[model samples]
Target: MTAATSVVAGETLPSSMRASVLTGALKISMDERAVPTPALHQVLVHVSKVGVCGSDIHYYREGRVGPFVVDAPLVLGHELSGRIVAVGEGVDTSRIGERVAVEPQKPCRLCSQCKAGRYNLCPFMEFYATPPIDGAFCEYVVIESDFAHAVPDAVSDEAAALIEPLSVGIAASRKARIVPGSRVLIAGAGPIGVIATQAARAFGAAEVIVSDPVAERRAMAMRFGATSTIDPMTEDSRPLKVDAFVDACGIPRAIVSGLESLRGAGVAVLVGTGFDEVSMPIPTIMNNELVVTSVFRYTDTWPLGAHLVASGQVDLDSLVTSRFDLDTVEDALNADKNPDNLKTIVEAK
Candidate 1:
């Protein structure tokens, strides 16, 4: 416990906290690090749960995702839920016990993108789990009070952690402008794809078709709310016409196929983080007049994500296939290797 005069939370603060650090690719170890103190308008939270994301796995398996390389010891995790144990100056002391979903991005408030309400595109973004930025793969972390969104009683800690991915789905849906009766096609059955499938319905899409080669994932997508599923390995998507297409698979073939599936003047929202670069046919772009775009992390999406889970419109529980403690972080990161697995969580507490 901390010194007598340093008591911040209801319980005595610990001098040190356990962390799972990645020294390099395929290398990780548990280490003890000093607990951090919150700055002004920040809160020291005890991380309760963290969802293993594909980006975390990429860092674990490959040392880097595109240009973001992990050259030093780094903690890899972003999707997180926690309880406020301490509040810093200018923060209300009453928030010491609030349960919250942590938004891992802190964009410079003065950037033009932030001023435009698109902080997700801020060039000065300090994001968690991205090289040089230590994320919440530990017991304690400090976050801006505004970014520590409170979750209602209806939202479970695990569900709260999944809110990060849910935000991506929400962002994609919003970017697609999925209006009532719009026909939308999603090109992946992974976590984001599955979440996007549910999001498509929430946005009032009349027909939400999910395309994946895996029959199992296709079935899972149906359970999540996809009106139809196509095995790109066997079925053809070229004949299908849709108002919007969201590429969550990131597979070149799937993306090109999704592009071919859209009708004239449709929207193509690319959320998949597969290839660093991809080429689209100039003729296809001209003929279809597709408005292609992509979304970064997210902004102001936590409350809506929480509402979807609380109201039972989105099912977060169905996505969890396994759980791990802080010590077994490696297992959590490698969970994507198993096809049967959908989401793996690291329960910090």
Candidate 2:
């Protein structure tokens, strides 16, 4: 049977499935909705794991992020993994039952940026959990088959869910062009910071240092491969110590501090999101001839992320610090906001 038929036929498919829908700022509810059908080129996936992202929490509390505003009630999750249950008309049904991670961004393939293989910059991208596009906080999600990457049998559903953020780390590493033995500094020892540290190590960085105010996060950073963890508030010290720096915290202060931490001609990749306006030492960047790069999201990195986890190179198990059921997504998000939590996931049963 085709994937679509399989979804309809599966005993696991409930008439109505639980979903965490965002009604307004700080207003989320666990409601039931009819299982949706897959459109052409789409596949229906029975969601197994959903990661609670910083962006998800920002939207929940603020009702908007950057240019995207939640004008309507929307489902609020994107980082996810699941098993394909049904395929659309043009999709290959053979993919059914495959455990996969979904790449949430669906860019218009015909866009100029997409044609250049930098689809992450595509202006017409429909990303899940962003304003208009409903996310995978539900039991089932219908997504484009091409965006759903099959995970290796060795990877667990929980690890597969982490592929989303892992891809971001990979993308940031690629953007910075991290070379073997390069001295790397990652600002912010949060989830992305920890993953970026690991990704930089995977890319052969000689020394990886992470800086954050949270002592717990810095401690976790050491466990995740940070050569040193710095508390910027602790003391003022020599700042130009690293060959490359990654601003994974997104806070303006972190970005500014990352710029200060880089060596001459070093590259700094911005991987986090935050307030639009922030002051920086522009003259230092010009004088040092440093390159500053920003990553919107990921492109062509999910499969590699899954591979890294399956091969046991990324150590996803240590990164997933918390998990919640579909009904407690709000609590999960709120908990993640706490400094103690590393990364949180919502499991759909």
lDDT by residue (1-349, candidate 1, tens digit) is 2212233444678889999999988999999999988887888889999999989999999999878999999998999999888878888877878899999988899988999999998998999999899998999988898999999999999999999999999999999989999999999999999999998898899999999989999999999999999998889998998999999988889888888888999889999999877888668878879888888778899989999999999999879999999999998888788899998999998
Best of the candidates, lDDT: 1
In angstroms, give how far residue 174 of model 2 lies from its true place. 0.8
Off by over 4 Å in 2: 1-3, 7-15
Candidate 2, 1-349: lDDT as tens digits: 3335645346656667888899988888888899888888999899999998988998998888888999998998888999988888898777878888898878889989999998999999999999899999999998888999998888888888888888889998998889899888888888899999888998888899888888898899999899988888884424656888898888887788788878888898988887788897999899999999888898899878877777777888778878899888889879875677898989986
RMSD of 2: 1.8
* Clashes per candidate, residues 3 or more apart or on different chains: 0, 4
What ranges in model 1 sit over 4 Å off? 1-9
